[model samples]
Target: MEIEYQYHFSLPRSVVWKYIKNERVLKNALPGCRSFSMVSNNIYKAEMDIHIGPIQDLFTLEIRLDEDQAPSLIELHIKGNGNMGQLNGQALLMLKENQGTTMLSCKANGQVTGALGLAGKRILDSSANKGLENFFQILEKEIKRRIYELKRRNR
Candidate 1:
């Protein structure tokens, strides 16, 4: 399966980049995430409860930051398994700044096995798209909240 998404933030690319890699920000943004912890410098382990169509399961995922070009690009590799299925994927995220706004583009490709593989492409695609959208919305809010906290602290 493949997923692509684009989002615009009313903040500079540099500011977005500064907070994007924060563990707290990511943990708060990820939908249904129960636990998220770093396993190494660039690797993380996460447990999430995911629901797709009529199927729901708790997934254990290992995420690796494969490549990073600060304030511009990031590449990620992920693998996860649950009672429903297993998944493996790679994602490339690019950020472009225009004036004070930043545009984020994400492209991801993955394969699923077991029950999830039999769930059909349309269902999977819809669920993935919705999930990504929700994640980004929450992320933007979290970033803004953090920025507010920073300003308060500096005052």
Candidate 2:
């Protein structure tokens, strides 16, 4: 499966980059995430409870920051397993500043095997898109709130 997502933030790229690196913010942005913690430098563990159709399962995922260029780009590799199936994927994130806004984009490719994979491509794609939409919506709201708080404090 392939995943692509893009979001625009009114804040500067630097601010966006800083916020994204925060574990709390990332955890909140990921849909269905129950717990997120750092295991080591640039490596983290997360547990997510997801329900698709009538199936519900808790997945344990390990995420590694494979490559990064501060304030500009980051690459992540993730592996996850659950009673439903197994997932492995790599995602690349790019941040670009234009005027006062920051544009963030991601591209990911992965394989799903086992019960979840039986859902077929169309169903999986639709589910993935909905999940992405929900994730970004939460992220945007948090980013705006944090930016507002920072501005208020600096005043």
Candidate 3:
């Protein structure tokens, strides 16, 4: 399956890039994430509880940052396995600054196998989209909180 999304953040591109690369922020933003840790440079291992349609399972995911261009672009490759299935995917994220706002565009392509694959493309797409939306909402809140804390500390 393939998915694409675009989002605008009220913060500057530099700030958005910093938060996006922070492990703490990502762990908090991901839905159902049990653990997220860096295994090596640009590589991370994560355990998450995933529920998609009628399937629910605990997945172990290996995420690799394949390419990075500072505050502009990032490419990621992911591999995951669970009792329900196996998942492999790649994603590209691009960020552009407009005024003080940061615009993010993401494109992801993936394939699923086993029981999860039986859930069909429509269900998978819907679930993925919902998960992304939830992630972004939580991420926004986390970023704002961090910014507030920084300001308070400097005051």
Best by lDDT: 3
Residue 98 CA displacement from its true place in model 1, Å: 1.1
User: For residues 12-120, what per-residue lDDT tens digits would candidate 2 score against the true structure?
Assistant: 8988878776788889889889999899998999999976666678999999986568879999999999999998999898999999998889898989888888878
Which digits, one per residue and each the tens of the lDDT, describe model 3 over residues 53-149?
9899999999998656887999999999999899999999999999998998999999999999999999999999999889888888899999999
lDDT of 3: 0.92
lDDT of 1 by residue, 11-88 (tens): 899988887777899999999999998989989999999898988999999999855677799999999999999999
TM-score of each: 0.97, 0.90, 0.96
Give me candidate 1's TM-score against the actual structure: 0.97
Where does candidate 2 stray beyond 4 Å? 151-155
Please give the lDDT score for candidate 1. 0.92
Query: lDDT per prediction?
Result: 0.92, 0.86, 0.92
Candidate 3 positional error at 1, Å: 0.3
